[model samples]
Target chain A: TQLLEQSPQFLSIQEGENLTVYCNSSSVFSSLQWYRQEPGEGPVLLVTVVTGGEVKKLKRLTFQFGDARKDSSLHITAAQTGDTGLYLCAGAKNTDKLIFGTGTRLQVFP
Target chain B: DAGITQSPRHKVTETGTPVTLRCHQTENHRYMYWYRQDPGHGLRLIHYSYGVKDTDKGEVSDGYSVSRSKTEDFLLTLESATSSQTSVYFCAISDMGQGKAYGYTFGSGTRLTVV
Candidate 1:
């Protein structure tokens, strides 16, 4: 079983559409990070949330860390073709190592 | 994958043969990690290092072994390759010095196929 479970394993949306992807876990984390990965490339760091109940916005994307630090959500507005990729969430607990979620594959059609 | 480098971007090996993947970093990060990415499984940790000569197993560390002899190099080896072990491997580096805010920088990844 994956420590971090991501919802909507596969997502297909049209350009300009909006959607939210969720990462959930029963265990709390000290730090959580979001990443976007393109085909034939490694994952690129998107954002990191350490404080509980913290929210951050990156251009058209919004990320929120759950109050319990066991969940997180990423919402993208006005999705574009460039936003298409595999999204992964990783959580760090007491150690320096990170546990990654199952990942969500997003396809935004223009 | 700017600061980190993974060698042999692609490789094909026969079952039962031993294979080794290399991860070299110039950033001097204190931590190095190895992960395998598979469909439906995302990326699963194979092993990781906290410092030179210090390593530990990860979620899916079976059939794999790691060694970190220096701060900039972490190596992952598959003792006996199997078709089930065929997957894309990624190397990641991390350092915890930015006021507790932490994130990982990953290598471009190595595509390994076991025939």
Candidate 2:
């Protein structure tokens, strides 16, 4: 079985602070996707990185896939209250199945 | 998400009782998956179906069964509810295979509790 391990399981920061969440695994993946989920709702797709060492930016969020395709990271710039949520990283191999990371719970306070 | 829906937003039942959860989709996506989310465990895939009457177990398929008799509905049943089974269940739909670059659209989720 493949497993994705995420770091800093819980994060609490003030508004305007920058934070980085990391997702690591010993197994390599063909593609990796990032998602952010608010309370009482399912996670929403943020971005998908298919290439090693590739970086994609979406507004204030930036996602990067490691050179080995075995890790990924999500960086938030000037996080706001609305950016507070559970961030999840999902990796897929050659099949249709997706293995999701443990998750990073972020909280931004005023 | 928009096209996917999960039934019984919240349910609480006694242990050893059978419990079933439903997932309905209108997008006509060929792939459907069931997952359970728990603190420190993120979302764990329970089962998935590639097409009607076709299904496969996921990483945490033990003690759970799934059936996909129709194109639009997928059902997950717990043979006998156990306290450890209490968790938020999510259903997701995707039109692409290998999940590729496009991620899945997930339902609000079904909160199940076993006492």
Candidate 3:
């Protein structure tokens, strides 16, 4: 079975600080997706990267797919309280299943 | 935020008791998935349905069973509740064809505790 691992499982920073979360795996995937989940709620999709070395930006968040499709990263610039949540990365092959990373919980204090 | 909804937002059951969780969606999406979320484990798929009455097991289907008799409803059943099964369950939907790049829309989730 394929597995995805995320680094810095928990993070806390002051508002305006920058932070980066990493997701890695030994198996290559066709695409990778990022999701943010608030307390007591299901996760919400943040972005999807399909091609190797592809980068997508959504407001203050930047997501990048690895050149080998075996890893990904999410970076937050000038983080705010709204940016605090659990961030998850999922790797998908050609099938319907997606392997999700452990997750990174971020807390941005104002 | 999709039209997906899960019933019994929270439930408590005893060991050896049977329990079922319901997931309902109004988007008419062709695919629905059931997943369990734990503290260290982000989300693990337990089962999924591609269409009405078409279902398949996922990575963590050991003690779980699923039935999809209709397009909008997917049911997950645990024959006998176990303490290890206590976790938050989420239902998700996607409309993309196979091999397509798309994200899933997830329901709020159900928190179950087995004692």
Candidate 4:
């Protein structure tokens, strides 16, 4: 089984600060996805990077997939209170099932 | 936002009781999945269905069973509810080959607690 490990299990930052979360794995994946989950709600997909060395941006969020397809990173610029939530990264091989990483909980305060 | 709905957003039951969770999709996607989210374990797949009457186990399928009788509905059942099964459950749907390989849309999620 492919295991995805996320760094900084918890992060607390003040508003306007920049932070980066990392997701690493030894096994290669066909696709990689990032999601944000809030309290009492299921995770919402932020982006899906299919190719190696791919980069996608959504507003203040930037996602980058490693060239090896074995790692990914999420960078949030000027994080606000709205960015506080649990961030998760999932890797998919040939199968439909996603191998989820140990999530990173972010707390952004004003 | 994935045309998916999970019934009984929150439920509390006693041990050894039977419980069923329903996931309905309006998009008529061919792939459905059930997953549980815990504090430390993140999200773990319990079961998934590729088509009607076709189901398969996931990483944590023990004590849980799933059924898909039609293209739009999937059911998950727990024969005997256990405290360990208490967690937030999520339902997701994908569009066969394209959706599965690209990404998945998740439901609002259901919170279950077994005492």
Per lDDT, the best of the predicted structures is 2
TM-score of chain A of 3: 0.97
Give the Cα-based TM-score of candidate 3 against the true structure: 0.96
lDDT of 1 by residue, A8-94 (tens): 999999999999999999999888899999999999999999999999999999999999999999999999999999999999886
For B55-99, candidate 4 gives per-residue lDDT tens digits of 999999999999999999999999999999999999988885433
lDDT of 1 by residue, B1-115 (tens): 3699999899999999999999999998898899999998889889988899988888899999999988988999999999999999999998863214778899999999999
**Which structure is stronger by DockQ: 2 or 3?**
2
| A88 Cα displacement, candidate 4 (Å) | 0.7
Clashing pairs in 2: none
- Candidate 3, clashing residue pairs? none
- The two-chain DockQ for each candidate, comma-separated, is 0.56, 0.87, 0.68, 0.57
Q: Lowest summed-lDDT stretch of 10 residues in model 1 chain B?
A: B94-103
Winner by TM-score between candidate 3 and candidate 1? 3
Which of the CAPRI classes, incorrect, acceptable, medium or high, describes model 3? medium
lDDT of each: 0.92, 0.94, 0.92, 0.91
- Model 4 lDDT tens row, A27-94: 99888999998888888889999899999999999999999999999999999999999999998888
Residue-level lDDT of model 3, residues B28-106, one tens digit each, is 9999999999987779999999899989998899999999999999999999999999999999998874424888889
Model 1: lDDT equals 0.92
How many clashing pairs does model 3 include?
Answer: 0
Which predicted model would earn the best DockQ?
A: 2
